[model samples]
Target: MKLVGKTAIVTGASKGIGYAIADHLMTHGADVVITARNEAELATAAKQLTEAHTADKTKAIPVAADVSLAADITRLFERAVEELGPIAILVNNAGNSTLDLVENLPETDFDAVVGTHLKGTYLGTKAAINHMKATGTPGVVVNLGSVETFGTTRGNAHYSAAKAGIDKFTEVTALEAGRHGIRINAVAPGAVETPMGQDATTPEFTAAWHRTFSVERMGRPADIAKAVVFLASDYAEWITGITLLVDGGTHLRGLPDYADFLLPTTN
Candidate 1:
C-alpha cells in the first residue's frame, strides 16, 4: 500500500495499458479516478474496479472525457479532485496513432494525434501540478512516452515527434516543479499488447516484434503497468525528469519496419 491514501487520476483508463496501470495503482492502495472517451466502457471499468474491492473501495470514479478537448480535460480533473479529494498522482496515459507515410498521412489525423498525445499531456501535466500546488500535496505526474521517440518508424513521424516532445517536457517540468516537491517523469513503453497494438499487428509487425524485441513475445500491459506504479511510488521519490523505457530490450535493437504498413499486400 505504498499509495495507501493518495488520490490519482488516470486518463484513457477504459482499457489497455491505462486499465492495467489503474488496476495496479488500486492494488497498491490509492483512490483512482479513471477517464476515457467511451462512456459505457468507462463506467464498466469503474464498476469492476469498485467491485473488485479496490483501495478504499468506491474510490473509483469514471468520467468519460476526451483528453484532446479542454472542456473535457477540465471536467476530468475538477471532478476527480472533488470526488477523491486531493490529486496526488496523475498518469497521463491517453494516446492516439497514425500509421501512414508522412506524405499520405491525413492532416486531420496528424492534428488529432498531436492534440491527444502532445497537447493532452501538456494540459494534464499542467493541471496535475497546479492541483498539487493548490492542495500543497506535492504529488507525482507520469506521462506515457514511446520507444518510438528514440527510434524510427517510416509512417509514425507525428507519434514519434510528439513523444519526443514529451520526453523533453518531462525533464523541463521536473526541473521547474521539483522545488515544489512535485516529481515528473515519462515512461516510454516499447510495443505493448493493447487495443492499438493489436490493431497494428500484422505478419510483418508480429515478426518484427519477435525479431527486434529481446523478449520472445509482445509486451503485456501489466509489464508497463508495473514500471508505472514504481515510478509513482515513494521508492522513486528522488527520481524525476527521466524517460524510463520498458520494452524488454526491444529498444536495444531499433524500431520495426513500419513502412510495411504501406506496402501492397497479396490477397
Candidate 2:
C-alpha cells in the first residue's frame, strides 16, 4: 500500500474519471474525501469506495462541492483534514467542457467550463500547498489535463485553453513548491470514454480518435487512474513538474476533427 496512512482530497469524484481515481486511491490505502456538485451522487460514490475497498468507512468522506467556487474548494480541503487527517495528496480532477465553436460558444458556457478547470485546479493546488507547508510534510498533487492542450480541439477552444493552462500551472507550481516538499504534476489523458469524453465518443468519433493511437481500444478511466496512483506514491519521489500522458501514444498523433460534433450545420 504505497499510500497507506495518507489522506487525500479528490475533486469531481461523483462519477467518471474522478470516481475511478478516488476508488483507486482508497484501495491503495489513502483516506480520501470525494467531492462533486451533486451531494447524493457524491455520497453514493463515497459509500461505494468505502464499502468496496476499506474496512474503515471513515477512509472515505463525501463532500458536495462546485470546484469552480472558491468557498466550496476551501471547505473541501479543510474538511479532508478535519475529518481524516492532514492532506497528503490532492487530485484536481474536476472539469467539464462545452461542444461549441469559438464563434458559437456562449460567454456563460465558456466561463463555466474555463472556471471549473483552470480556476478550480489553481484553487486546489493552493489549498494542497498550504496544508503541506503548514505541516512540513511531503505532498503530492495530480491535476487532470488533456492531450487537447498540445493537440487541437477545433470548436472547443475554452476546454483546450483551460487544460493547457493546467499544464502550465502544474509546471510552475511544481517549481515553486518543490522546495517545500510538495510534488505537483499533471496527467494528460487522450480521448478517454468518460462523461467528459462523451461528446466525442460516437462511432465516427471513435474511429477518428482511434487513428491517433496504436492502441485499438478506447481509453478507460482505470487506465488513467493507475498512472495517478503511481505518481502520487513514493515510487515517483524523483518525478515532478511534468505531465505523465496516459494517452496510449495518442499525443504523438494529430487530433481528430471536432467540428462535426461541436458545430451546428447551417443552410
Count residue pairs with overlapping backbones in model 2.
0
Question: What would the per-residue lDDT of candidate 1 be over residues 105-135, giving only the tens digit for each residue?
Answer: 8999899899999999999999888889988
Over all chains combined, what TM-score does candidate 1 have?
A: 0.95
Task: List the candidates' TM-scores in order.
Answer: 0.95, 0.95
lDDT score of residue 254 within candidate 1 = 88
Per-residue lDDT value at 259 in model 1: 78
lDDT of 1 at 255: 78
Tell me how far the alpha carbon of residue 158 in candidate 1 is from the true structure, in angstroms, after superposition: 0.8
Q: 136, model 2: CA deviation in Å?
A: 1.3
Please, what are the lDDT tens digits per residue for candidate 2 over residues 1-267?
468889988888888999899888887888889998989888888888888874644467998999888898888877877898789999999988777777778999999999999999988899889889999879999999998887886788899999999999999999999999899999999878887677545677788888889676778999999899999998999999999888888877888878864453821
After superposition, candidate 1 runs with Cα above 4 Å error: 54-58, 265-267
**After aligning candidate 2 to the native by TM-score, how far in Å is the CA of 92 from where it should be?**
0.2
* Candidate-wise lDDT, in order: 0.88, 0.87
Predicted structure 1: lDDT: 0.88
